[model samples]
Structures are given as C-alpha cells and as structure tokens.
Target: MTDLIEPDALLFNPFMPGFFEDPYPQYKMLRDEDPVQNHPLGFWFVSRFDDVSALLKAGLSVEVGNLAPGVMMDQLDSLGIEDGKHGVLNMSMLDRDPPDHTRLRSLVTKVFTRRAVAALEPKIVALVDAVLDRMAEKGSFDLVEELAFPLPFAVISEMLGMPPTDHARIRELSGTLVRSLEVVTDEEVARAIVNADIELAAITRDLIEWKRANPGDDLLTALIAAEHEGQVLNGDELVAQVVLLYVAGHETTVNLIANGVNALLRNPDQLALLRERPDLAGNAVEEFLRYDSPVQQTRRITTAPYTLRDKEIPAGTFVLACLGSANRDERFFGADAGELRIDRPEARHQVSFGAGPHHCLGAALARLEGQVAVSRLVQRFPDLAFDGQLEWNGRINLRGPAKFPVRAT
Candidate 1:
C-alpha cells in the first residue's frame, strides 16, 4: 500500500491496516530507505538492528522527566496525561532511570533468575497440561481464551499469591491500562487508561493491605518485606511494583504463546519440526521470540547527543527503538531473517526481551512458559490447525492475535 506514497508520512503509522496486521513490509522499507527516522513529532525512529541495540544500551533515559520541553510533552499534554495520571505507568521501574531502576529491579530480579525460573518447570508443565487438558476436552477452541491467556494469568497470580478474585474484571482493567503504552491519539482511550490505572491501583492497594495482614511465602509478601538501606518500598512504591509485576507478568507471555502458536501453524514445517523434536522446545521459544516479537517497540529519551551511523539524535529527544524490526534485520540475522528456522544459530541473540539496564526481568520465566506452552500444544494435538479467521489485536506496541480459533484435535 505504501509502495507509491511518500514513506515519511505513512511509514511507521501503526494505524495503517496492512501495517497493523503485518508490519514487516513497512519495517523493511524503513530499514532499507531510512534506518534512522527523525519524526516531526519530536521523536526519532531507529529501525536498524545495530542502531537499536546501541540506543538501548546508550545510557538513554526512560523517564519522561528527562525530556526537554518539546512537542512530545505537548502531545502528552494535549491528551491530558499530566503528572498525576497513569500512576503505575509513571512509577514502575520500566519508566525509571538508574539508581532507582537498579534498586527497584534488584528487589525482584532474583525471583526471575535462571535457577528460579528452572525450578518452576514442573509447575509450569502441570499448568500447561491443565489448560491443554481443558482444550482437549473441547476438540476445537479459541487458542487465546483456552490456553494462551489463562496459563500465564494463573501462574502470575499464583506467584504473587493473589487471593481468588474476579479474573475477568482484572483482565479488563489491565487490557485498558496497557493501552497507555501504545499510540493513543484518542482522548477517550487516554482517559480510559487513566481510569483503569486508578481502578487497578485501588485494587492493588487493597490486595497489598490484605497481604500485610496475612503474609505468605510469595512475591507480593517479599515485596512487602523488601528493604534497601533501611528504606522499605513505601505505599506508592509497593503498589507500583506489584501492579507492574501483575500486568507485565502475564500480558506479554499471553502474546508469546498466542503469537508463537500463530507463527508455527503458519509455518507447517516448523510445527512439524517442533513435534518431531520436543527437545528443541527451549531453543524454539527463542526462535519464536525472534520470528514475531510480542513487544514490538521500546522507547527511551536521549540523555546525551546519541549518534548512530551518520544521524545524531539530539539530547532529550524521544527515540523509538523498533525491536520487532531489529529482530528481522537481514544484515544481522542473514538473508533468511524473514523466514522461521527453529534451529537458527543466532536466534538466541534476538532483542525481543531487549538489552541493557531495562531488559525484561521476566525473560527467563516467559521463555519457560513459551517453551512449555508451545511444545506441549503441538505434541498433544498433532493435527492442530487454524480453525477460523484470525484477528490482530489493534495494539501497536503489544501486537498479537486477539481471536485465534484453532482445532485442538
């Protein structure tokens, strides 16, 4: 569709229908024609692999406070996203710069270490089986509803030792809250996000208070007890971290399983390969991450003048490091970068979980979940196939299928 139009106006427009469903074509154009795009909106788009990698680890600031007075702030201001709104979005370590980021991340990093994640293998296997068993009962089902969505939600809830509550309501609130991370031109959506954040924060506070009364051997309890230099996470900090963990813990992995299954089914050979060799489950998850990243882009504010190739992004500018594009860069991943090869040697190097200081803390856990979920899925139902039309979730940042109808038998 963009083959005839000017690339500058429409190229990175996630609203475009074709680009929303399949963004690779536009991504390829950006990489080929303009690897570093200086958007008119006071932001820079870095599409190349090396440049993206550099930008991520270039000591850039994730905090919006570092952004110089610019159109970006005006954009946010226009949407009514002021200081007090979007509470968890602002407070989480994902939005913090160093010292604070280091401190906040360290509080829960050990829980997601390789050893910790590995120890959850048996539990993960059981959980996956539990969901798959339900799927088996219904010969055909929506993959998202049946297996992909519920598994991670259960795991995260269990890890946090959350009391049994209304799952549907929380999922609704979370789905709305995450929209804050994506492109929001609609004031309605912006307000909805703010409202969701408020509601979710209230729910989280109540949960934290409940945990305070009845402590347990779980992450929420640990966060409640965590201290650094005699300073514990105060009320707001505790709420922010717990909310971040709850949202990030399940949402991305939901996309991972759904997207991984979508990719494998689309590539019959890869699905067959996974079925033939179950041992490839772990590595296959990495390849799946590379093939179609659940999280497409991560943003950072330039702290200093950042030069990439020949382009120098000025300090305090918003730079969108396109991880999805970088993962498929031909220059780095070879000529078949667009193709899915489960055994691809460089698959593990994909920046789907990102790199540097703000790299995803739940990478190990997500990998384990994806490995188990995807591997057991195809193995259990050898004839697994897409049963109906697929619908892309209209989210630019966390892009995946919203409706994934599939045959389990």
Candidate 2:
C-alpha cells in the first residue's frame, strides 16, 4: 500500500528560514503534487510552468492589491500599517490596473527601449571596470557589497542625474523602502518603511524641483518633458515612478550579479566552461536566471473565475505564481532542471523577467548588465572562488546572497 500523506505536507509556505536556505526541493514537490496549491493565507500558489505562464498572461488579471476590492488606505489604517506615514502606494503605477497601468507605462516606455539601454552600455562597462579595479587592489572583497550592490545603484542614479555624493543616501532610503514590499506583514517593518518613505519623499521632492529648473539631458529631465497624447505624468506620478525605477533597477541587477556569481562558484564545471568560452556569458545569464531567479514570485488577482488542474479559483482571489518553481519544472526544462548548464538551449524560456503586458521594462538593461558583469568577473579573476561561507539574504520574495565573500586568487 502507498504511504499515507501528512495533511500539512501539501501546504507551501516560504516564510521560514529553512525555506530561504533552500527552496528548490520543496518547489519540486509542489510542482509534482499540487501544481495549483492554495495557501492558508488566502491565495493560490501556481507552480507549474504552463499554469504560471497562463495565469500571468490572462488579460483580465488585476494587481494583487486589488484582490481585497476596497480602499487599500482604509485597510492600512485598520491594520495600523503606517509605512512611513505616506500615501505613495496608492499613487504608484506598480499597484494600479488597466487604464492607469497603460497610461503610466506609456509615459516611460521611450526611456527604457532597447536602443536607449544600449546607449548606456559604455557607461555601464566603465562603472564595472572601476569596481573591478578596486577589487584587484585588495585581491578580495564581499562581492555583493563591493561590486553587485553599488554598480547598479551608481548606474541608475547617474541616469537620473543624481550626484555621486548622494548615491549612498539614496541607497539607504531605497533599501528601507523596498522592505515594505516583502515585509509589510510585520508591524515593526511597517514602521521602518514609513520612515524610509518620509525620507525618500523629501529627497525626491528636492530632485524633482532641481530637474524642473535645470532641464538637463538626464533621464529625470527627459521624463519631465515626456508626454503621451499631450498628457504628462503629474508631479506625484513622476516621483513615484522615479522611486520605483531607481529601487527596482538596483534590486534585481544586484541580485542577478551576486546570484549568478554564486551559482557559478557552486558549479565548478560550469564555471570552467564559462572561463574557457567567455562567449557563453549571455546564455549563462539566462541559465543563472533559470537556476535561481532574483524575483521568486509575483502576485496577481483573478478578475474572473479561472480553472487550473481541475481547481476552480473565484474572481478576486489572490494568486501567487511561483516563478522560481516554474523555471525549474522538468517538463519544460527537461530532466536536468536542477543542474547549472551554461549552454542550456532553452535558457531564454525562463520567465525571470516575467511576461505579458506588464513584463519588466528594464529586462534588456538587466540582461546587458548581467552579461557584462559575469563575463568581466570571470576574465578579471580566473582563480576566483569562495573565501568564506555564503549568507542568504532571508528575503522570501527575492532570492540572493546577502554577503558573498570571494578571493581574487
């Protein structure tokens, strides 16, 4: 007779420390057993590649925040969730749906186009080189702190015409602000987010006024001038979008460089292959994204009833599509889903950048950054390897190393 299953075995929760350390095995189990598992927290977790893809591509889908179907500010007040005593969230395009999302995205689409991102490649390479030179002097460093974190922050800030001196302050504000997305459920964290938001708003207001007066060639000035059908982003929208872009740009690319390096270190053979064939750096990035994505999951709300694997989900139900799990599904990626293959043929198939109308706007920039960072790191330190134990960031929504110590031996 088959072994009896535990009732709680099917429940998938990623909040635990153990899950942060390693979530793949559990992800596999979820994909194999309950591809459309429902969580006790009142959301469906979709793990299979096909199902996750379908749900994300669903035209009637709404932002996860809309799942509650009421004024979010009222909910925040009821829960005492004072995230920096600000009303910024409601003004954010990231949390909006339909006409609002369409309008906001259109305002900045020109700025994020592939051609625009390509024009910034020379600057990105110079920034990467400067960091690598500093690492070469020490012959060792915390990869995340010294290289991964600062590089993207510097690039994004430069694009906004932010002075290099203000980069550190912006980083601090961004770090605290992003936590609201991942840890808003915790009361203590909610308050920290509030402080960050207050500080961020002050800084952003100053910058907006400066850009308005100066009207330089930077992205901030360009955004200030950009309009769609003669409709431009208001002051609030501009600040919200700038904050979103600055934070989102750093968060993912930082993780990508750190996570991609960590993955290469773990798989020696793949590392060696990359060292020998630097041309594969582009493909290797895709593989790294597939193996351990930066963004683990994205939430959406059903606008209409939907069915998956015989499970019926009602309208307004929050759904969490497990992007990390779906990327490793054996059916789509073949049996070697767990291994790091630099030349994996279908690496681009991974949904690390997400999909559909709301797909990541910075996807191309992220790819270029990853390819350059990884390729140059291998070239700079052929003998690079772990210098100490790796530290997981403990973020349930985003996956990456908190501190990755490496030696340039």
lDDT of 2: 0.80
Candidate 2 TM-score versus the reference? 0.92
Which candidate number would show the highest lDDT if scored against the true structure? 1
The lDDT for every candidate, in the order shown, is 0.83, 0.80
Clashing pairs in 1: none
- Evaluate model 1: give its lDDT: 0.83
Local accuracy of candidate 1 as per-residue lDDT tens digits, 54-78: 8888778988642422223235456
Q: For residues 1-409, write the lDDT of model 2, one tens digit per residue.
A: 0122244466666653378888998899999988998766566889999998988788655555535322232344555545444535445666678788888888778666677789899999998999899999999899999988888888788777764457777788777777655524555565666667767877887788887887777787778778433566765787888888888889888988998999999999999999999889989999989999998887777778899879999888878788899999999999999999999999999998777877888888888889988899888898998999999988766778988999995
**TM-score to true structure, per model:** 0.93, 0.92
| Model 1, backbone clash pairs (residues 3+ apart or across chains), number | 0
Backbone clashes for every candidate come to: 0, 2
Q: Which residue pairs collide in model 2, if any?
A: 83-194, 84-194
